[model samples]
Target: MDFFRIDLSFWLQLQFSARVALRLPAAPRSLRERTFLVPNPILGVFLHWLGGLASGSFYVPYRRVKHWAWETYWLVGGFFSWIIAPWLLALLLTRDLFAVLRE
Candidate 1:
């Protein structure tokens, strides 16, 4: 069975009670497979998305540019990605960006 399907089943069983018995599939066998099992898959997925957004902007240049030389485009894009994007997002998302940054 799919890993996420198994996780969803577990989550729903917990939510509605064991009376909603699913034929829980055999647990993953190997250590690597077992490593993905979480007590709460919803929080796990949301945290993964939050991590992705925190590390975003890597693909900005690749998507928007086709003509500029490698170093030129990357320098410009990296400047915006590393320097401008975080501050811009912080300002837009927070009520007290400057105070938060002071820490």
Candidate 2:
């Protein structure tokens, strides 16, 4: 659909801009270094490993699940992963979750 294409294009543009902005500047000799508060490179490696583990194992568990259609399983997995996990984590971790969400 046209709306989906437009939205995807906007998201891709945003991602590309983020990638560009996150790249290091060429001319450096400044005494002060700016940051985006990204964690250490070691943490990035561990995060990358964890993500790869998750994605690699994504479809395997579905094979053990009998009787459900692919669409059903996919829908359930996507719903919990995209919606439930983040909300649950935030609720558990944040001090004032409702106020932050309201903002």
Candidate 3:
């Protein structure tokens, strides 16, 4: 039972991470260009909705974690979700990531 719960939590985390990655490409740089790059308004709306769903459900996986301090698990998750993943995606998506970050 414990093993199963741990596996489920990891699976949920993976799903949540994938959802976040999918949403990264939809990040809008400017208000004017918000819906321009996307082919249709509906598609943009759907992407935004999906991102919201992912954000809302992201904490569900953490609930399954056991035998650890909340801060310990949160910090580990935060490192991946907030820092490493964003930096990696920005580097992949942007031409001059450092220049963009410096501004």
Candidate 4:
């Protein structure tokens, strides 16, 4: 397959995964819950869209990189972006970064 298809597939998977997490009873609550203890579907949707765009945009840079095996570059970049970046970001955003992974 092509890069766009691969990137979009990963993005959709992440979106679906995040949706499942938000449905959990102990989802760090939400940005809404942190301050007001109320859920906001609007904010959730916006955040989802923002994440989608950010992921797609980050993948764009890989499109310009050439002369390397697709499998090689894709795996390396995907490992850093999907795994490493998320782990660090989760640590910064939530104190319980390992909670969801443990579930």
- Local distance difference test, candidate 1: 0.65
Clashing residue pair totals per candidate (backbone < 3 A):
0, 0, 0, 0
Q: Rate the local accuracy (lDDT) of all candidates.
A: 0.65, 0.68, 0.65, 0.62
Local error of candidate 2 at residue 31 (angstroms): 18
User: What is the lDDT for 31 in model 3?
Assistant: 33
Q: Can you rank all candidates by TM-score, best first?
A: 2, 4, 3, 1
Off by over 4 Å in 1: 1-40, 43-65
Q: In TM-score terms, which candidate is top? A: 2
Q: Candidate 1, TM-score vs. the true structure? A: 0.40
Candidate 4, residues 1-103, lDDT tens digits: the string is: 1322222211122236446532323333242233222356998999999989987786576776777788978798889988998788888998676786788
Write the residue-wise lDDT of candidate 2 on 42-87 in tens digits.
8789999999999998888788787898899999899989999999
- TM-score, each model? 0.40, 0.58, 0.43, 0.45
* lDDT for residue 88 in candidate 4, whole number 0-100: 89
lDDT of 3 by residue, 1-103 (tens): 2322232211122236446532223323453232212146887899999999988987777776877798988798898889999889999999998898799
- In model 2, the clashing pairs are none
Better of 2 and 3 by TM-score: 2
